[model samples]
Target: MAIIGILGTPYNTVERSPFWWNKVSYTRQSFIDVFQELGHTVIVLPVDKTENIKNYLPLVDKIVLTGGADVSPYLYGEEPHAQLGTTDPIRDRFELAAIKAALEANKPILGVCRGLQLLNVYFGGTLYQDLSLTSSQIKH
Candidate 1:
């Protein structure tokens, strides 16, 4: 059976400003169940580690980059923006390492929301702030 490695998102508190609290990584029971129904195995990977990533990368056929925080702009050569939200530098480094490994290994990667933003930044792209004010005049 093909194994799909799913990256887990961090547990954050909305009340705490820039909270970087406890993070739990696991392939949700429902998610795993769904994959089993499809005849594949769902493998969960911690998005907070460099070593665990290396150990899991070789075992999976595909990589999943889940959405969470902002990718430090420094990774793409820019200072932080005013509207930028909280980010995890350590997590950024770990995920970046995983991304590079996935690319080198020629494994398919699936990114969601913030994950997509990270992937874009990883590939030398930029993000827009206040889309309505900068690009369009749509109201909130």
Candidate 2:
């Protein structure tokens, strides 16, 4: 069975008890479900634990970047457009490093939605920031 590493997003929880807690999480069940159905083991890697990613690389057969926040425009040398939503620099940094490691290790890398965009940007490609701003008639 192939071992897979799935990147997680940061989340914050609002508790009714007058305090809120911040969390690092991966919400999509399909990523794990599909992989498990295929007889592979899934490992959810939190962004905060990036420093230890290298230690886990040899143990995983592949790295999967699941859907999450936008890639910070700053990574591609552009200012945030008015339509840009909140971006996580920490996640960006970790994922980019993870991608490089995966490449060097000759392991396969899979990317969903936002994950796809990040892969593009990492290879010197640019994003629309907001698809609606484009002149195309198609709506996303």
Best candidate according to lDDT: 2
lDDT of each: 0.76, 0.84
Model 2, span 67-113: residue lDDT tens: 77788999888999999987888888888998988999999999888
Which candidate number maximizes TM-score? 2
* Pairs that collide, model 2: none
Least well predicted 10-residue stretch by lDDT in candidate 2: 16-25
Off by over 4 Å in 2: 15-19
Q: Could you list the CA RMSD of all candidates, in the order they appear?
A: 4.1, 2.2
Per-residue lDDT, model 2, residue 65, is: 87
Mark the 10 consecutive residues where model 1 has the least summed lDDT.
Answer: 19-28
Question: Where does model 1 exceed 4 Å of error?
Answer: 12-23, 26-37, 129-133, 137-140
